[model samples]
Target: MASAPQQSLPLFYNDLQPLSSQQHADFKIRSADKAPFLAKQHAVPVTVEEFPLVQRFMPIVFSQGEEPVPLALMGLNEGINTFFDEDGSLNEPNFYVPAYIRRYPYLLARLRPDSDELSLCFDPTTDTVGAFEEGEALFVNGEPSETTKNILQFNEQFEQAGARTGQFMKELKELDLLIDGEVTIQPDGAAQPFVYRGFMMIDENKLNELRGDQLRKIVQNGMLPLIYAHLFSLGLMRDIFGRQLRQGKMPEPQLVQPTA
Candidate 1:
């Protein structure tokens, strides 16, 4: 299994604090009309629960590194998210936003390193969040309000999904199914085809070599569909590459220097 991505605080998270009545009794999470936060992100973390819906629009791929997580590709290259426009607003209004993005500001994190306890915390740096004179109150009369409870429930579910994703990754790794991924594309008038590497993908050849009992166990475990979903989504790589090419977002190919 890919080593878990180095455990670090996610993006936009700074000065996390547990939701407290004394600290944020009158605070509310304002409704934002758009998601400018995701504008610059080319890939976003997702889970098995989201695979069925997410596979339709974006190519689902695993992130490269020790801790490999499922990623929904918004663009073929880094820092290029085709889903959002110049203002960071989503171009496709109907596109399904990943729960990881929707659960922004609120995340379950360990407050202390000494123990394994996790706390529900929010990012104070987000402009959309904070103590407000009005809107939805996080705590009313020193008790969590309905909105707060709902957010907590959603975050819990998200955490659960994360656990399942970890198990899925473990299974893939144990099966030795993941291998280095590469894709080649040729533009209509280009002199040469472009090849992309550095990412990891499921090895179909290895999958085909699994024993009958192994295949039965995987099928019984309900992992077969998820594996198929991942394989099917790879077909969209060309679409994404083309989208970037047509939108003029493709970056210049890297040139390797000769070694002495």
Candidate 2:
């Protein structure tokens, strides 16, 4: 085992956190209100790790001030992407020479010492200590002896369905309305964009009859399905702040100890 990262500490998060909002009105090229909505969708009551962990508390988020933040649903993506540290073996350089090389031990001076003893000096890779961020490693189910292999059957299906839905919306919005993107704008002086989620709107019942409820059927079937496509007053705040570089865009990023 290697030493832990230095960044292990108590980090508390709150309802209102750092959200980037455009300070200047002139820089805004698109005259639409940013799509700003609390990502409460992921918190929809469901089973996790065969235990009711999330439902114990009512999940909620809101805009506290000028800044806008978006919370996305992690759902099964967290469990599915998880893997073990010792899952794969290391690839040593020039691992071993067959018996052919051992016969002629004079070829490599390193093997000369072992040939007399009928042994081989393959390699030693596990000597070096590994590094990881503090508190990033946790024993799932309090069982540290065994590591888990990520098996997200539903998570994979969820990702595929979300991709298809995004494409479908792009096409629909192009044909039905010449929307630059998902979010629309008010016909006012600013022409500010209104938060428009194609997945959220469109009346679920209407699509149920039209598409024969393929989307609805996915979620109802116990897959944390992509039922809504969020587009609202909240601009991609993380994009504005370049948080993807510092933090990350994906959900449940592997926790690692941050080092100086």
- Number of residue pairs clashing in candidate 1, backbone atoms closer than 3 angstroms, sequence gap of 3 or more or interchain: 6
RMSD in Å for all candidates: 5.5, 23.8
Candidate 1, lDDT over the whole model: 0.79
lDDT of 2 by residue, 1-260 (tens): 22112233111111111101221111111121111111211212122221122112211112112221112222112221111112222112322211121111111112233453211111111111012232222133433212111112233343344355445445333323222223343323533433322112233343344444554544564322222323221233223123222223333323211111
- lDDT, candidate 1, 70-101, per-residue tens: 88888877677788876778887768888999
- Clash totals in order: 6, 20
Maximum-lDDT candidate = 1
Residue pairs in steric clash, candidate 1? 2-66, 3-66, 3-67, 4-66, 4-67, 5-67
For candidate 2, the 10 contiguous residues with the lowest summed lDDT are 10-19
* Deviation in Å, model 1, residue 90 alpha carbon: 0.6
